[model samples]
Target: METAQLQREIREFAVSAGIDKIGFTTADPFLEMKNRLRRQQESGFQSGFEKGTPDERTDPSMLMDRPESIIAIAVAYPSKMDNPPKGKKGGRRGMFCRASWGQDYHDVLREKLALLESFILERCPGARLKSMVDTGELVDRAVAERAGIGWSGKNCSIITPEFGSYVYLGEMITNIPFAPDEPIEDGCGDCTLCLDICPTGALIEGGRLNAQRCIAFLTQTKGSLPEEFRTEIGNRVYGCDTCQTICPKNKGRHNRFHAAFEPEPELAKPLLTPLLSLSNREFKERFGHMSGSWRGKNPIQRNAIYALGHFREEAAVPELVRILREDARPYMRGAAAYALGKIASDEAITALGHAETAETDAEALEEIRAAIRNIEDMQKEVPK
Candidate 1:
């Protein structure tokens, strides 16, 4: 069978398989991306989670033998949840970003890619195919953009015309030289909303990002979050969607077709206090299936503590006090101490004072002292 005819059949198969968008591109090295990544690395703008060296990441041929063309696929996820849980003053809740609202996208996309690989192999015997999802060495965004899946939005997301930036992307490299699709033109004309609205200003003047300052990246780190980004982090437990949600292109584009990507409000926006007490086993049993749980419960619990502090939820003071007193993890204890200070009730202040006296970890003790100082300052500002 001819490659073009096969490509047409594959496109139909992809759409039938529930892939929202599909495009094809040559397996040529992404020279521009390589240079940009090198610059990003030099400027210390990269998120350390990125896999592979620049060369391997840019050159697709190096990843698969005789890679002649690449197939990029996008699966749209729901941008909005029906009957979303509300977070109030007393019953504060932390949010998982839209990306992590449902089951892990890695598994979802991988299943689709696996099916696509099987279809290709049956059609073309001896066809060489290597499939990859988000964790792949090659950049999904660049490949998708080059394959005409979507234009790269100013927010650094591949914005599809049909689904906006609310889509999961994956790709397959095949030895067959399928005809390539035309790349889309830039559509972000004069729209700086995503840049101006980024909580930590991670978006650069161009379409680049300073990943270190990004709240999305910081939320995944397993340590005491830097003090500066804490307030901006707000109630987000994992990932962020500020830029995507604010994009003009994404206005009114909410695709909730896939049941696999559907969110359970209780899990997506769980109460902050309950999160503080979840044992590892409980955490996995509850949230293990969600993509946001990839970094484990430590970061989520730590962020939940910060979220309670951000809201100054007085009801959470007891839980914060308990964590400050007895939590084994120093980061959790320290974060709870900070949260208690933010709450600023007499009980919270008293707990911080007690924790300060008994705290042996120097870092946690510092957090306690800082909380005490802040609370004292807050009290001083009020009229007697």
Candidate 2:
């Protein structure tokens, strides 16, 4: 297959595989992105950065690794449901973001990516193909931007004007060379909604992120959360979408495409209590198929306490106390104490008393009292 013919053929295969858009680009290093990464790391915005983290996520190795031509694709996960219901949520009527409303996209995208690779392999027998989703360190957003797919929004998410940032990105690296698409000019001129609405101020002075302050990272990170950061976590149980929701580009985004984007049962406005009760086995059984669950059930479980705190529903007291009893991580335990303090139930009060007995952390002990006071205020129906 010739280059032009191959591009058309590959695009056809992508569309047939349920992809929304497909574009091609040549391999190029992202040296301009180096300073951005450096700033992010220095500002403590990175995760999984134990040591020796590669620059591939910001560099062009993604395209240059083994291939000369790159194919960038997107899978949209649209939502038709309303935002999750506010206050005392249980059962299905609650809320879920459109992205997580249904089957996970990682597996879906992977299945298609492999098939796309197979399609390429069949066309070019000697050509090697590499596929990447969110897990790769290569700069997917940059590649997509270069391929005329979209431009990176102020929030750092790819914004395809028509599809917005509510889409997932994937790539196919192949030895089969093809012409690269013309890069799209930045369209987010002077838009600050994504930055203005950030509750944690993860968006710094420039269009960058401080991962430590990012609610999404706070929800998924292992270990206990700082007391100062817990209350700000708000109602988000897993990841934070505030920036995306506030993006003007995403305005009036009615999810009519991507039928695969439906919520898992538990994820459809999960009860804070029931979620706190899930063990590793139960957590896996419930959220195993989710892209959010790959980090293990602990982080999500911990965030439930924070959500309950934000909800301040008396109905969630028993569940919160139960987690407080079995919770071991200082961060999670701390979040539990903070949430329980906000609930202020007799049951919660009793549990906090018990937690205070052996709990040695001075800050956590203070938060326990604060949690109890918050519960008292809530019980009195006082405005926070």
Candidate 3:
């Protein structure tokens, strides 16, 4: 069979397999991406969850032998949840990002890739193929851009004209020489809404992101969040979508075709107070299937505390007090203490006072002391 004909067949097969978009590129080193990555490293801008070394990440041949063509695929996920829950005064809710709404995307995309691999191997028994999803050695976004999947947006996401930026990307590198697709023209023009609207200013001027200041990255972290970024964390329990949500390109873009990516309202926007007391088994039973639970309950619970604080929900004070006084994990204890301080009611102040005296961990003790100081400052400001 002609390679062009085979490529056509593969494309048709991809559409049948529920892949929203597909594009092809040659096996070439991403030299420009390598330089940008180096700059990100030097400036401490990388999220640290990135998989491979710079050289390994930029070169396809390093991963697969004599890779002649690359296949990039995207699966769109729903941006809006059905009948989304609203947070109220007493029943404040924390959100999981749209990317994490449904089942773990890693599993969804990998299933498609595996089927693609099987389809190819059966047609050309000698065909050599290597496939990877987000956790792969090569960068999924860079591969997608080269394969004409979309233009890289200023918010550091690949924005497809059809699906906006709410798409999951994956790729397969093969030895067969398939025709490469043309790269898309840059469509961002002069829009900087993503940069201007980022709560933590993580988005730099030229499509670069300082991941250290990114709320999305911050929510996934296990430590007590920095005092500066705490206020900006808002009610996000896992990841953030502010940059994508504000983009003009994503206006009215909502893909709901894939059932696997449909969100359960209760899990996607869980109640904040109950999250503080979720046991390991309960956390797993409730959120284990979602991608947001990848970091386990620690980050989610910690972020929930921060979210409650962000709302200054007095209803959460008792739960925060219990966590501050009893949680074994210092980070969780510290975050709870901070949330108590943010509430700053008479009961919250009293709890903080008790925590300050009983807390033995130096770090948690500092958090308790800081909360007490903040409450004292607030009390001083009140008119006599």
- Model 1: per-residue Cα lDDT over 1-384, one tens digit each: 899899999999998898999999999999999999999999999999998999989899789887999999999999888998887878888888989988899999999999999999998998999999989899999999999999998999999888999999999999999999999999999989999999998998658999999888999999899899899999999989999999989999989889999999999889888998899999999999999999899999999999999999999888888889888899889999889889999999889888988999999999999999999899899999
Q: How close is every model to the real structure, measured as TM-score?
A: 0.99, 0.87, 0.99
Worst 10 residues of 3 by lDDT: 348-357
Give the 10-residue window scoring lowest on summed lDDT in candidate 1: 85-94
Better of 2 and 3 by TM-score: 3
Q: Candidate 3 lDDT, tens digit per residue, 4-123?
A: 988999999999999999999999999999999999999999999999999999999999888899999999999998789899999999999999988999999999999999999889
Residue 23 in model 1: shift from native, Å?
0.4
Candidate 2 per-residue C-alpha lDDT over 1-384 given as tens digits, one digit per residue, 9 for 90 to 100: 787897889888888888888888876566666666776677667765323244666544543555687789888776446554444444212233455566777788888899888888888888877788877666678778888889888898898977888888988777777898887788889878878888878887546878778887777787667767877876566777788888888888765666667655547667666776777998888877777777887777777777777666667776676666666666666778887676666777889989878677776677677776666676788655
Ranking by lDDT: 1, 3, 2
Model 1, global lDDT: 0.92
CA-only RMSD, every prediction: 0.8, 3.5, 0.9
Candidate 2 wrong stretches, greater than 4 Å: 49-54, 58-66, 82-97, 326-330, 358-384
TM-score of 3: 0.99
lDDT of 1 at 223: 86
Error of 2 at 354 (Å): 3.6
